[model samples]
Target: MSTHKPLGRFLTAGAVAVAMLATAACSGSTEPSSEVTELTVILANSTFTENLPALAETYKAETGITVNVEAYGNEQLNDTLKVKLNAQSDEFDIFGYQVQDVMREFVRNGWLTDISDYVNNSGDWDWNDFQESARDAVQLDGKVYGVPVATERHIMYYRADLLKEAGIAVPTTIDELEAAAKALHNPDKGFYGIAMRGARVPLVTQYSSFLYSYGGDFQDEAGNSTINSEAAVQAYNTYGRLLHNYGPPGATNMGWVEASAIFAQGNAAFYLDADSQAYTFLDPQKSAVVDQVAYARFPAGPAGSHPYNIVFQTLGINSFSQKKDAAFDFIKWVLNKDNAKLLLGEHTLPVARSSAWQDSSATEKFPAGLVEIVRDTDSNYVGHDRPQLEAVARAREFVGGPAVTAIEGGDEAAVKAAAEQANTEFQALLDTEKR
Candidate 1:
């Protein structure tokens, strides 16, 4: 999935600048010798937002640093960070960045300071605690750029009860999967065989899983675009057929949120998505079919089994932040074993630390499936070829624009042509950015 979660427009550049100016002005005049130094943090607006204020209060009580937290949607925060960093302003002390693709530019430009020295020096913090892959995602050219807060792995979630009712077993192969979908599909009754993400980014992410199953990657290790290969064409065709024939009406408009909602609402026979959606799907308050859900590995493809893993949003200190030391300390304190346990207890995000995964208290609180997901990830995971910032942007634009046109316009020829165009543009982008 390229690790870049879509950042929605929630906060504007002007708004962030105004907010920072106000905070700086307030801090400058009133608090010259105050015991607490206010640290400004930019974070994603998710369920975790509720936990921050409480964590901040506790941190203040313990260490006496008053933390000022501002929440933005994922994309909004990235945009804000980009604007501030490009201007070389220390407006934000820390930013929550997910995709390494987005962070690559900052790392390459030396706009992000390496915190490896700080992490190594901390007596209480154990760098070995984090999962190797999750930790590796934040490392560039053998230096740590950020600390991961949580991780996610994708899996197949199905309704066991519905499958039994239909007298169909969980399909393990591509053909079997299609048969299962056909058996479960009931358009008149408002139930779909499967709920797939047909929307822009979600489509690209979900499509990649299928593409991988067919032994096709967006790029090989040598970083060449393979989108129009025979295997890729087959995978794309399969996706199109699934969406057109088995999915619900208006499926083209459904993103992760809508897809998850359809599955949780008891109308979907199977849903494949990131494991992070587990809590919401199982929550009785959120899901209508909470008790009917069952989890399994991704269905096998022509080549072999292929499932996608999504690591959690990473926490990075602004390279320009004056509070570099304090920021590193805060990161250590938050991601360390004890605090991670506490956070997992409240909200069941998979901690990046392997040691934290082994905690009995954590096992008692989080779902057993979470541990399984983590294990499966550690053992059998494949990552996208890390793309440069421009290449990654081109991929997003190409996939998003073409996939949307195909689904909404219902023109296969147009879709194929668009894909070709996108591939051409992607190659051009790579050529231009070649070092």
Candidate 2:
């Protein structure tokens, strides 16, 4: 569980460059410089990518290096990296990836470099400064694989004006939340009570918080599927009931953009999704309820309030890259605490560094209520928003099938049967991985 260990007593000559980073860091020198003068970095089209061009320019000015930056859409990045890395092409020295989706698979395939020495030995990089949940996402079997760059968590978004008009308090428990949804629901007026992702694959991540708080998980202690556990059935029913009964008519087709739009357009009283959606809800260009939107922790369920605070994006060095030193240095420079502030303060994006959250720059930039919710959920948060599996997409599709049924107005018996069927398939997938 330790990310940092005393610099190993004995070191190979190949480790000299890595070991030197500690001494330079102790003196607070800018991250180590590499002789390599050019590097290519592939990144997803994310909010954070906007900061990189300027950073690359600054780094070039300081280090005489040329950074070639290429960006792709989410699906494009996943597909591109799969083929590029599988062929062991070193066209890119570094890459930004969706941590939850492919980190385990990449690690298994040895596509990512083990940067344990770089992360652990550097006082400047300060691995311990990262949130525990963020750190856990990049580690497997006590080895460091990548650095988490973006963080997000599920939270409740509500229309404060509507809640006040309805005379219902912000819910603290699942039952109270359901009651509030029921009381506020009014489809005739074209205003439903709740909104959330309902598309089968997309819903799996959001439902994970519900699943955990209901005392169920994708797998039990022994890596067996629990999709049909009593707690899981209860979670599926509650999530489905809210979206099916109190949500929009076509919620089965909605993902984040679609579902959150309902809340932003003033058609829903409450929404549960990533806290990142708060910015969208607050945007005057897009939101009809800009002034009325507010934030709260995910309501407690039978098990307690276990919301997901997960690493949404990560940076990894290509295992086959000839410029590993330059790649590591570039990672350290861009993901430094100083840069984290740029992401948090200027962009209002959630960051992995704890210090960035405490800075006044970041504090003044984010909504006070949203920051409070982060403080409350940060301590007791789940690490992964979906099942922790190598074949995560397939697992999500299989396990999430029941939630889709529940959302389509399936009865209890039908939902139970779907869960049983999904569990058998999910179990087979798990067993294959185990073998």
**Number of the top-ranking candidate, with lDDT as the measure:** 2
Please provide the root mean square deviation of candidate 2 (C-alpha atoms, Å): 7.3
Highest TM-score: which candidate? 2
lDDT of each: 0.68, 0.82
Candidate 1 lDDT, 222-243, residue by residue in tens: 6666676666666767777777
Q: What tens digits encode model 2's per-residue C-alpha lDDT throughout 199-237?
A: 999999999999999988999878899999999999999
- Weakest 10 consecutive residues of candidate 1 by summed lDDT: 19-28
RMSD, every candidate, angstroms? 8.9, 7.3
lDDT of 2: 0.82
TM-score of 2: 0.89
Model 1, CA-based lDDT: 0.68
